[model samples]
Target: MDLKKLEEFILEVGAENIPLGMLTITNNSAAGQPVSMDNIRQTAEIYHSFGIPFFLDACRFSENAWFIKIRDPKYANTPVKDIVLEMCSYADGCTMSAKKDAIVNIGGFIAFRDPELKQKIAQNLIVHEGFLTYGGLSGRDLEAIAVGMHEAVDEDYLNYREAHTRYLGQVLTEAGLPVYMPTGGHAVYVDGGKALPHIPHSQFPAVALGNALYLAGGVRTVEIGSLMFEHVDPQTGEPVYAPLELLRFAIPRRVYTRSHLDYIGESAAICMKEAQAIRGLRVKWAPPVLRHFMAQLEEV
Candidate 1:
């Protein structure tokens, strides 16, 4: 979150209307960029001063921690786990999905600093989900999450993981592919707008590039730009647009080696060469909300 903008907004709104503030580490919607530790601390301070609790969407906490360790000079020698704890200390609680950093197959959990809030959460859990203990999951699943959390913070594993992602970005960039720079910990984002300038935003260029990647080499990717971020206004009927158009290739945890990424990069280069031939898409049918997730589209 932008602290300055938040402060101004809070002052304008008198802060009472806001219940809490949420921040995500390694924000997924924006090319998996990590939030700076100093920024997080300052945001926490701002929220606390306003009497608003700060929470974290920390699905990729380990990856974010590793990024901080290498990127930030202040945390150069700090252990990844220690850095992670310090980050968490600023926020009152966090919601986590074990599928990401934890490497668990399925399941998610929440942590809270307030015992009173935990008790309330337990009661709600029983009503909507299952018991507070397992929440419809078996003991084995919980064990996997516990162990995976520990493995996720291992310095060696994090080093290799981040390096692998950076390597893919470097290779694709060297091949003249328009990928986002300073490679994110999770994925390589291709700048679809620059790559497919012939296809305008209204025609969903990023979505077209994603489709082209799939058709070219059977490599599936998601567009994180206007196609995914923007939508048709139900009331005004105007098409809202996002600032940037991106095609993302999310690298699954411990799933592929450099050879696999090498093939992907080569495939992307080939696709870029044939990009002009790719046709843009127009939404044929879409729901009222989250249209990008399941919208039907056809060649424009």
Candidate 2:
């Protein structure tokens, strides 16, 4: 995280104008990079200095804790659950998609350090979601989350998870794919811009690379690039694109084995070998917002 850039943006925008500040622990869009505990603390200090409430997009909190334990020597011996608590200590609240780290099939929740805020949010939740009693989830689902959240922080499970993801990154790199190094917690992101230099960001090279991977071996991936982050500058009326073109392979928990990961890495390598033949894409139709989710495209 660039502390200078964040502080600059907050200052430029005026802190009073900002409603709240949020930090995604495993910087999801940036190759799922893990944020260190020190960075988290410093960020919280900045937000609080501006009288802004800090929140966490903590769906993958456990995974991030594991990274902190392994990467930061200071926390090398700390328990995963303890690391998770310390990470959350800096935030005023957190929003979690229980489906991720909690390992539940469905259900999500927002937590707040202030009871007044919780009560206020609950009112909105009651109107849009189900009653505050269940929060739109079944008893079974809630129970699952209760059990799974504890399991999510199990050190043994996290160790295996890291190893599993690292293996895929290694395989992809060895097979000549440009993978993000020091592989992140939950996903292996390929540098699509480097892998498919023949295709340009204007034409959505990451999307094309994603499509190629699917065609090669049914290895589905998501494009985190111009297709998702591009926008027209209201002032200049020119396109502003994401800095990196990434193809993310999010490894699901306990869903696939190492062998399955091998297949995915092999598939990406296959796509890379014939990357020159891969065509760029142009949007055929798209929604005004979140075009990546529902957009249709044609090869350019």
Candidate 3:
């Protein structure tokens, strides 16, 4: 989603000319969803054509691994550990967000076998972050990350989470609410555009939905819109354009039970049923970057 970060990484890798062979992408998948080995192979081949090494953002490898094993029984005998390692081997390096599949408190890691690249990245990591030895992550957090990574691969855990997501999706869809197709992750996405087609991007649909959900059931969700990109002009001090607003309901793994998810679904249904358009908020310019969060709202 954050293409900026990916572009930066690509630039860094390309600068070294490390023969970056392949880049793996998901096929409309979500967190903890399975991906096919054939998909991976095809992606690798695409990159191989360019004679560059390939790397996958294996944050959801656990789900993909399971999917592959189930879909292709021929690989049933192959251990997930081996499959993941082999996939990683196709790339010179890979990075994963520990907070997702790993389910750690909050952390991330990049792995590579190349001694030179590893050393260089490690040096930069030390200066930018903390020492690789410390990396600002406590030992307890590291242990949790390790354990969570293992737990993420458990069939029961993945199944339960997937079922819960599907249940929520079904509830919202049956209620005639706009919902994205259920994928592997624990979250359910309510399409703000569908929910409020009349409301323009500048009106911030996600923020409106979030506020409505709170008023209805005290539930909180985030907007994945371009609100973060909106900026006021320096001289005239006016917004260039309104940003897209999307509400994201993130479900933490093993936290909320089925009943809780049902409650969320119910709340979403209620909010959508009673949804109203948000009137654009007028902005009064201030020096420097405006803290939208601190801006006072009045029903204009």
Candidate 4:
């Protein structure tokens, strides 16, 4: 996170205008990059100083802890569980999608230090979801989450997972693809704009690159560029585009082998060789909000 930008924005907008402050641990939008421990603590301090509550979107907390262990020398020898605990200590609470770090197929949860807040959330949950005990999940699912949460913090498992992602990033880079530096915890992001310079931002280069990867080896990837972040400039009434066109290869946990990644790298290489022939796409239909989720498009 850009600390300067964040502080400047908060000051410019005025603390009274802000409702809540939340930080994503493994900032998924930025190639799953892990947030530093110092940054989290400082961010929480900033929010608390302004009388704003701070929360964490801690879905990949375990992976993030692992990154800190390997990247920051101060915590090089610290236990993953200890690192995780310290990370959470800086926030008032956290919301999680258990599917990511918890290693569950589905089901998520919210945790807070305040009992009053917990009661309020539970009351709402009872009205919309199920009872306080289960909260719409079966007992078995709850058990899985309980077990998965512990396994997620296992250093042996985390080491393997980090190495696994790095391997793919290395292969992609060696294959002449412009892969993002310092491979992230969960996924490898390629600079689609660099690969498909022929396709402009207006044409959704990231989407075209994703399509090319799919066609090359049946490998699926998500576009994290204009298609995902495009918006209108309210002041000028002009469309705004993302600065970087990126394609995210979000590898599923405990799935696929090195061979699979090799095939993906080869597929990307093929796309690079024939990148000039790739055509850009034009949106045909879209929703008013989050158009990328279900937008219809055709080659332009």
lDDT of 1 at 123: 96
Q: Each model's C-alpha lDDT?
A: 0.89, 0.91, 0.65, 0.91
Tens-digit lDDT track for model 4 on 123-228? 9999998988889999999999999999999999899989999999999998788999888999999998998888889999989988988998998999898998
TM-score of each: 0.95, 0.97, 0.73, 0.97
**Model 3 weakest lDDT span, ten residues long:** 24-33
Model 4 stretches astray by more than 4 angstroms = none
lDDT of 1 by residue, 99-193 (tens): 99999899989999999999999999999989999987899999999999999999999999999998988987876768788788988888888
Clashes of 1: 0
Name the 10 consecutive residues with the lowest summed lDDT in model 4. 1-10
Return the TM-score for candidate 2, rounded to 2 decimals: 0.97
- Per-candidate clashes come to 0, 0, 8, 0
Candidate 4 residue-wise lDDT at 102: 93
lDDT (C-alpha) at residue 218 in model 4:
94
